[model samples]
Target: MTTRKDYTRPLDIKHGRVDMGHGAGGRAAAQLIEEVFVKAFDNPYLRQGNDGAALAIPAGHRLVMATDAHVVSPLFFPGGDVGCLSVHGTINDVAMCGARPLYLTASFILEEGFPLAELKRIVDSMAAAAREAGVPVVTGDTKVVEKGKGDGVFISTTGLGVVPQGVDVGGANARPGDVILLSGTIGDHGVAVLSKRESLEFETTIASDTAALHTLVAAMLEAAPGGVRVLRDPTRGGLATTLNEIARQSGVGMLLDEAAIPVLPQVDAACELLGLDPLYVANEGKLVAVCAPEATEVVLAAMRAHPRGAAAVRIGSVTEDPHHFVQMATRFGGRRVVDWLSGEQLPRIC
Candidate 1:
């Protein structure tokens, strides 16, 4: 005979709608938690009903915190959705400071009348991503907006990390002659999301490279201690905007070899068809590293060894030009100025 525990049919997750009861502090909310959040993100800390989580910190390391909000249109996209992107985006932000991400706090703004099934899918994805990255969402808040006032859902994540002593990395640290390295192909994330948005079918599907890159950064730092000058993830404004920010912050110039930059042919073709500049496209799973020239090879080797950076390449170098300009040498043997993006090309991309 099936006991009540065994007969609890998972809260009707398939066809149920998210009514106001889901956000109410009542049995309905508890049922949602028990069936969805608890099931997806099982952990000792979360199981405790305290208002906050208790964690132990390691000695000699300073904690780093970073937060990001995700309001990307079309919650579901190729290779990732808003759920996984939320986790990776904040994790990457914390890791860009050369820290080891430890914990995450998430907030959800949900729309009433949304499908419980979809919400569960997104939450499951977020839980899976956090688990895979070895981070836990220790605390979270959920609020429901009237049906039309909000998108399907919006997620904001705050990440906590530990930065080791004597390791410094920032946009202001790029020095002249530092080699610039790209983790892998550019424009993949942006194009992937764009394709899904426009329903633009392609011969070969392009998937977003949405991933947490802290481990890759750790490996690179270990291989070339003190040689890593700066690190930045090219997300919103893409490589051009990110490089320009670094150049202006460090008061240096950059010269990128266009041929050395990697872009999938489908992405390039899509960009051409859409009149979009790949330089200004967005990326979720790539990093731009500015390292000492002597350490470039070692850093590249280290990056290639990581699953997140298997296609790492040396793409450019910092220069001493006074204008803090970023220029690219095209494959046609001509150079063109790569300036900061004038306006948002693809807004709400992250």
Candidate 2:
């Protein structure tokens, strides 16, 4: 290697495409990182260009980490693309445990021949999301594969946070008499992706609710201060599947008020036309909070104050039942079992 004479030109982001050399961990890879990811995600740790980031977390707090892989098709959706989802998903997972996300790392798998412009757009979006969330992408890796062997792009993000002392929230923490509160409407993310994937025409615009919730979670924690029993975001299987998972984990039963659940009229109609149940659809920006009945008002108020949780409402309550089942009341004056999602209703709808 030349110490001073050798030089590499900037990447042709304007009209270039990804290729096998970029993943070879060589000059091309270094140049790509310098021109794209590092420039977009400008930070001291990333600028160091080390193999990994070295973070010094504060003492007296337990660390929480979460990793998520995003392989949703249509790479770009109505309201969001895979970029924001990768950030929001990881941040939300850590926030569910009552942690404040502090940092993140990302990895990308790029298919050969993929347009560099699209990749730049995604990386720029991801950088913006990280900045908005007050977290930085400290380190990341990139790999390019053969053209036909991979899709456009796949992103895996790892988030790191610290849990404040005495703040414990998890799926198994739910108890009988705890009230369940839904942050907002359901099935928006799934339907938004579906609309683009299938080209289903809808009169109204339906956008994915994908967003980072760490700030909202911080506000909620400030209000409850440990009153919350279980906190979860209904992502893949929507509200029904997430509730069922929590029920089984806590070995408790739930009684959901169907009429209380919020759903956008257009999303409801879309589900009806597709023979899909909104309960099993997915949401990216919403959350399900289980808190003591006494703290419901406080937590709801905190959520409603946030722009994302504008539709916060009490949907149901935890109950004492040996069955560990999730049952729902119907608008037709009947009850139905909100069962576990048997199969994938919308795969790759992240």
Candidate 3:
């Protein structure tokens, strides 16, 4: 066998483009992973340099896992890019299950001829987000597709968490008398991406509310251990669709106060201008929670105390309806059924 020679120069991160060799599982592949991924997402588990991470799950705790794929167009947006969004998206999914997010795994699909500078920027952003959230990317895979066969980049992330004993949260746990709570204003994310994508200008800029919510979930769970019944992050389908899903699952109905649901003035305006409904728009950092009526005050207080949920409010309640519909009492003294969004409202929105 012949000995392999070391590279004479480092990767041209500033002016290079990814080639097929970077994903060939040879010298180029090893070099790319070592310089880009391993250097940025440095951690004990990742430093092991193994095919998979060996995580030590906490004793007596239940395990939870969630995965999300981000394909948002124009990779870069007003407030965030696909990088941080991928991390926040997966972490929020795990948190919505009432678990404490512990670790993350990232996978990248790079198109041939993609600029190395953009790739490095995205990786750095993902690293910063993971550090801020106290979670680390442990293991990941990289693949390259032929030019014109794929987009610039696509990221897929998976999060692993552990739920403490005595906590049970699920969509089916909602009851007829439970109260529904929203974390903050909706439609900010969808509008932010839309404005950037369509070049629609507004007096004020709309930014994506991409963030990790495990800490907020922890706070609410601590405040009412067994009182919280359901937790969900409204992503693709927005608030109305999410509520409809829960209503169907629990065999109940929801009655919402249109006035109580918070919507930023700019977001509402942007929706009106674009012929869109804010209720059908997406939100990245917001959450919908259902808790027993007796625990409403405590849960609301706890949610408001957290920065992520500072604007939390009681928006509605579960009701008995054989039709399992989600109805909203309009601020104008009329009621309307918040039906499921008809066709894809906004495609590739995370």
Q: What is the C-alpha lDDT of each candidate?
A: 0.90, 0.92, 0.92
Q: Where is model 3 more than 4 Å wrong at Cα? A: 1-8
- Residue 324 CA displacement from its true place in model 2, Å: 0.6
Name the runs in model 2 displaced over 4 angstroms.
Answer: 1-7
Give the C-alpha miss distance for residue 271 in model 2, angstroms: 0.9
The alpha-carbon lDDT assigned to residue 121 of candidate 3 equals 90
* Residue lDDT tens for model 2, 70-174: 999899999999998999999999999889999999999999999999999999999999999999999999999999988999999999999877688999999
Model 1: residues with Cα > 4 Å off, grouped in runs:
1-10
Lowest summed lDDT window (length 10), candidate 3: 1-10
> Candidate 2, overall lDDT?
0.92
Each candidate's clash count: 0, 0, 0
